[model samples]
Target: MNGRFDLNSLPMCGAKTRHGIPCKRKGNKKNGRCKLHGGHATGAKTELGQLASRANAQKDFPDWFFGKPVKTEYVIRALSSYEKLVELMLADEIDWDTVFDVVEQDQIPLEMLKYYIMFNVTPEALIIIQSALDTYYQETHAPHLAFHVYAPMIVFHKFFRQLSAPDREYLANWFKKYSSRHPGYNW
Candidate 1:
């Protein structure tokens, strides 16, 4: 049985574009893409993608300055530190200058943050990154930089959230077990 309906089944709106294809499929009330292309623009490719591509294409970091060091242990340690740094940044507001001070005093470079963001970043990391930026702004009372970072952070967060699975299964399981364990939320 053809479960689908024809486009003609719906009311016909005046054609917007001859070249532009029908916005809705036949008999299918929900809107969909035309024959040629896939579904509508997902809004996945954002200005950040353009900026990253432009920056990377335009400039190359010094090899030793950016890439993993010769010592495997150092590379591993640096990676671990990178995760810790991101987590810490997300957990609370912090002094950017204080962080840099530690880096300088310890002889560790601040470029590490930049590199981690650049190379190993996933969409989830952007949340922490934006939090870190907010933390910096809150600590320093700098609205200017915070304003700049906000857009990219929001964009990345939206994209990531869309891709993430809802905790439906986990929550369902939890509720089932939870109700069995405790009958009421209130004592």
Candidate 2:
């Protein structure tokens, strides 16, 4: 024999091989890979190389590997419905039960409410929503980490409850004013 091959004495590739066994070759100093396992290869530089690299990556991917597949047309329609629902929600501000259902069963994440539930509202409505948001922020004292400093649905319920009957009635009727402007939405 040329020499003794002491496994522990040498640095190993350590990367799994096609047969699911560890490669015995010495690891590259840079990335701990053997030459055949991309140790000698640098990343894609050219546009064509990048495209080829992406294609190679996706070629062996399993079904639904990147999470659920979204239908483009369905997504468009669903967004339209959600926007319409938000408009409708602006109408029934008094019914906290309905509000709870909308937030809970509707499965709309709080992230969705940041803009659509804020600036899209009327100035008078803004005062109401903004006041509730401020109160929620103050009460919770949660870290102002997310885009929405206030997102608790319960806070809105309490705020709406405290509103005068006239304001509630106005919100309950607000949709009627804009419903005609936005037709064809089933929401």
Candidate 3:
């Protein structure tokens, strides 16, 4: 006999059923199982089986499967609402005083407030908000609140490019004064 085993020379799986009938099909070269009983055998092909397959796939990625809102999704929704407010303000539907009132009341969240000041406020609107912040700071004697209000200027400094020269100078002077008052403050 030749030393090499050819495909034809490979043995059948010869696996028996409960009734003891031979499998009769050709076996795999590796595992020696018939194609029907091989590990590569396909799952069920029925509609119900397909649905179960899809469900199993979804189970592997439950977040996408359940359509849950992620952290960025909530931020996007908040920015959308903020954009709507800015639109109304620009259209003269809502006045600066109302926006200032919202900030004074602490109705706006700190994160959204930072975005609002950086992206949406005009020089004129900024003056009003700054004045309100000054008043709040004086009344409460809370330098931290002032820091919180201006922290966005440092964080979103790129937005400073949109400011007029006078506005930029004013903000620089403000920061200088704030720093002098709170020498230990890093911001």
Candidate 4:
């Protein structure tokens, strides 16, 4: 038998042109298209091209581009929990000592505090929470605790903006003082 393969037996591109003629380009082995005829045309090379590609991609998969909306029930539940905690604090039911103990013992997560800030709880409630956290920091001498409590205030500036001007300045000064205690520690 002959060792040579016949080129005429290979498949060609089925793409048509404006004149209703078949594309003369050789088809890819797998996809049946030449490179110039979209055999392996990956989108975009430059940064601008990438941006345009992303924009087009968003149109195809919009939900992936824009995150899912938050459920109203979840928001209500979070707000209610925050309100109850604040009420308990204001009513003198939960003192600083209890708060400190619960936090130090890991019964309550530090992330809960971050969430309170994220939810923009009442300014009065925030002041109370901050004061309790400051007391805990002083008594426990935990730099991490102080950082965790204050870092959110600075990082989420929108939450800080909700505070009065004087409150904002106070927090800024407090952060400066805390950060200075550990030289070279900047957050």
Candidate 5:
């Protein structure tokens, strides 16, 4: 078997085209016809089939963070830094240049936070989310607890405090497990 992967190498459908050309579509072993022709399955077309197809397509998506979609890992880590930077900025200890750099770097989170207020996400929720995310981030170097999970969390935050006790306990466990992963939150 040559390493080439051209149509000539595979078994072709025995059917003929309107122009009398041999069917170039791959044939199924049972009936020698591709799905387009007369293969056993014709693909998902019904409502249930379509829903199943969509669910299969979505199988790779990560689970929601507190019922909110999370930003990518890099954005999350930077946002953790952004949270810390903001505190240092408020203290007026960090230079403006450094503070601006971090803020500019975390554009995704900042923008989401900026406009989310218009949609009714109170600054109070923002405080809780940031603290949680930053804590998770520092603890594991894998901060996913918060930051710009964007619309999902923004929408979910309204119900943040009312989450099931088990979910809250899970988060509490994460904090306990890695409480001092980072050096004392300094600098």
Candidate 6:
């Protein structure tokens, strides 16, 4: 035998048997874990890459604007609303004397007082609301607008009581005053 000896007892060298290194099973085209786990392993990554590409297609705005530009068409359209809101917000000075008289004597609901002054809800309303909240805090030592600072959706389920004692106190007092003295209420 030309000095080459085939040892059948030596675990079958490259044995041509079903268990010999599992012979790259029939449908295992890409190797590694057969057809089940080997198909390029990238569909999700490719989809994410495409998504990122699309997202990056637009020029990013300044980081301060939260990816939104300052001069979008909506801003232009809201200019008039902004003006109206501001006008409504700062139209008149608060008359503490009248407020006290109404509260102490007239026994009117303060919310009624709020409607007397037109309060517009628009982009401009933001500043007005802020100013109102600030003034309420200053006058009553309480917070008037609790949900204004947080995402509106998130604040829905929470009450101002969840805030710090001082914040809660302020909001409560301010709301009380607003509901009692503001003459512009609709209801």
Clashes of each: 4, 0, 0, 1, 1, 20
TM-score on alpha carbons, each prediction: 0.23, 0.21, 0.25, 0.30, 0.26, 0.20
- Candidate order by TM-score, decreasing, is 4, 5, 3, 1, 2, 6
Which prediction has the highest lDDT against the true structure? 4
Model 4, global lDDT: 0.52
Top of the candidates by TM-score: 4
Query: How many residue pairs of model 4 clash at the backbone?
Result: 1
Kindly report which residue stretches of model 1 are placed more than 4 angstroms away from their true locations once superposed.
1-69, 95-98, 105-117, 121-187
Better candidate by TM-score, 1 or 2: 1
lDDT of 2 by residue, 114-166 (tens): 33344444335444433334444455573433422222221233244455676
Model 1: per-residue Cα lDDT at residue 120:
60
Name the TM-score of candidate 4: 0.30
TM-score of 6: 0.20
For model 1, how big is the CA root-mean-square deviation? Answer: 19.1
lDDT of 2: 0.46
Q: Write the per-residue lDDT of candidate 4 for residues 88-180, one digit (tens) a residue.
A: 567746666665664454312333343444447555655655555566778888664322321121234454334567656766776677678
- How well is each residue in 59-116 modelled by candidate 1, as lDDT tens digits? 4322212233333443454455456657556556755675443333311222224334
Residues 19-117 of candidate 5 have per-residue lDDT tens digits of 887777887666768666764566786433453565467543433333544456544654575555556555736465554455445534544443243
lDDT values for all models: 0.42, 0.46, 0.51, 0.52, 0.52, 0.37
Residue 161 error, candidate 2, Å: 36
Locate the minimum summed-lDDT window of 10 residues in model 1: 146-155
Candidate 5 clashes: the total is: 1
